[model samples]
Target: KFAAELGRGDKVRFAGSTADLKISEVLSDAHAIADDDPDLETLPSSEHALPSEPATFDVMKRVDQKVVYEKVLDELASGGTLGIFPEGGSHDRTDLLPLKVGVALIAYSALEKDGLAVPIVPVGLNYMRGHRFRGRAIVEFGAPTYVNPDTLDSYKRGGADRRKACNDLLEEIEDAMRSVIVSVPDYEALQLVHTARRLFQKSPNVDARDKQDMSRRFAEAYKQLVARAGTDPPQKWLDLQERLLAYRRELSDLGIRDNQVPGLDRERRHAEAGNYDGDDVLGGGRLLYHIVHLVWVLCLAAIPALFLNIPVGILARVYSDRRRRKALAASKVKIHGRDVVLSE
Candidate 1:
């Protein structure tokens, strides 16, 4: 219905699951893989399952994860844009999960093997309400991040080189995402996890406010370290600091604290004037309330039955269509300007 409304014709692209058949046709040319395989012997059983022979299960799980990681890395190296939820497969209200190192590993391998730079773009899909039609959604596209080839070489030589390189790339990607996203406390903590991972790599002792803060500090430290170790420390460090500071400033503008990260206030009003608890069932309840509370909903819905309804509906449709077209037009008006930076 959405595609028909947008005049997209049958060009829909689906990349995720079997349930999405219509869109799946568009992904036929892309390399798509399931995020997890519970049937694999090497994969670990769910935590709810009773413990089995420790040695056997441990070995199998390690092998399974390794195989999956390696397969993904190979695909990316072969010039395929691989998509995996860095947060694994959680559908909770949380912004993100602790990023798996698999993406980082693939990126590092791609750069090392082909001298190719793969851009990891963090896409944040915010739905007004889950599993609903005519709800507003915002898909935020972040900047592409490249893995430093020099860092990969060091990781390749070390005992835990692959793991380290993967973690590093994950941290970089997380930081990039944070720069573009509107900060919510829960999501911020997830970001901190990446920061913590980076800092813990440098020194296990230093700590931040929470996991998210730790991740941010760690990313900052890594950026500083990278600059300091470069040929021109002052210039590189300044540039890096400016970018980081800009991100921090944006967070501040949104009233998000740096050290006092809090979870998302569920009671807060949504931009679309809808309630979203990140649950399909809860969303249904909200939908019911909206239907019951708004008299306009019933009046507008009854237009098709009235004698004059056709003209009224046509006028409403035309006005709504014009408003949308104007919005799109206004969004496309971009200003091109030049800036001159003078260094004292």
Candidate 2:
């Protein structure tokens, strides 16, 4: 979406998944090998495991690494935008994962060459529903940081101590990322904290309209909550947390959101059809105006509703369900940093 900002013909290189790189070769080799081996047919069960030390897998991994790293560095040298996740893989984790040193290495290498100053841009992607179709997402970009020239000088002197320089840059990158993304303690805490923020943290004067701002506020509130519940925690905080937890559960069970509850917002009440401002019934003229407005809206909406395709809608839903299932299955392999799966 931001491609327009770059110069014409400037290439953008994104981090390709290791699975995507190896899946084709692995599948082909595995299929051929399985077909050739008569023992595969005689296996006790279809779930029987393959050999752990497959030569093909190891060779492919090494080749992929070399090719990816060289391409990344080469792109940087040619003034192309090299965008890498640094997290290695896409897993659903609330917190940022340990970053790989490839980005730092690229920056250091680029700076070593004359007339090249690599700027590492920290971008954070916050998702409202990661696994759902057409889910809302916000992209936050932090100020660009660079590898310290002094750190590079030290790195040159300590030839074997590249780790220190990489560590320094990575630390800065992590700090910058934490500011843009919401990193809660865990899934349960995330739900409660988000609910608390939505219900109690918004202010009319403040610019908390965006989800990112609200998330930052939520994180701050969470920090304060934790601080208040230090070694000798207060009972009130404990009680409040319990209440929030219960509220989350109730919302889940009822298949509703916090914003849907009446009286939650004094200025308006939200319904499935639309929002009510409570001034609609103030006077006869106002009531007539509301009726006319509702009719106009219905008339405008009828055009699309009348032409809505049932088959197309069904196909869309089916496709979304399949995609969600596939994503869920792929994400299930990693239990530690699974993405938060929710519906919008």
Top TM-score prediction, candidate number: 2
Which lDDT values do the candidates have, in the order given?
0.49, 0.62
Worst-scoring 10-residue span by lDDT in model 1: 335-344
Clashing pairs in 1: 14-23, 42-60, 192-211, 192-212, 195-214, 195-215, 196-214, 196-215
Residue 252 of model 1, lDDT score: 75
Q: Could you tell me every candidate's TM-score relative to the true structure?
A: 0.37, 0.61
Q: Candidate 1: what lDDT? A: 0.49
Question: What's the C-alpha lDDT at position 314 in model 2?
Answer: 75
**Candidate 1 displacement at residue 292 in angstroms:** 19
Positional deviation of 51 in candidate 2, in angstroms?
18
Candidate 1 lDDT, 1-344, residue by residue in tens: 23222221122212211111112122233322222222122222221233333211110011246677667667777777877676554342333334555677667666776777888888765432322325554566667898887787766786556555666677788877775433433434334434335424544345323334444455456555655677656676567556655656666788875433323343343535675556966888899889787878777877667756777767766665565454433321111100000000
Cα displacement (angstroms), candidate 2, residue 269, comes to 14
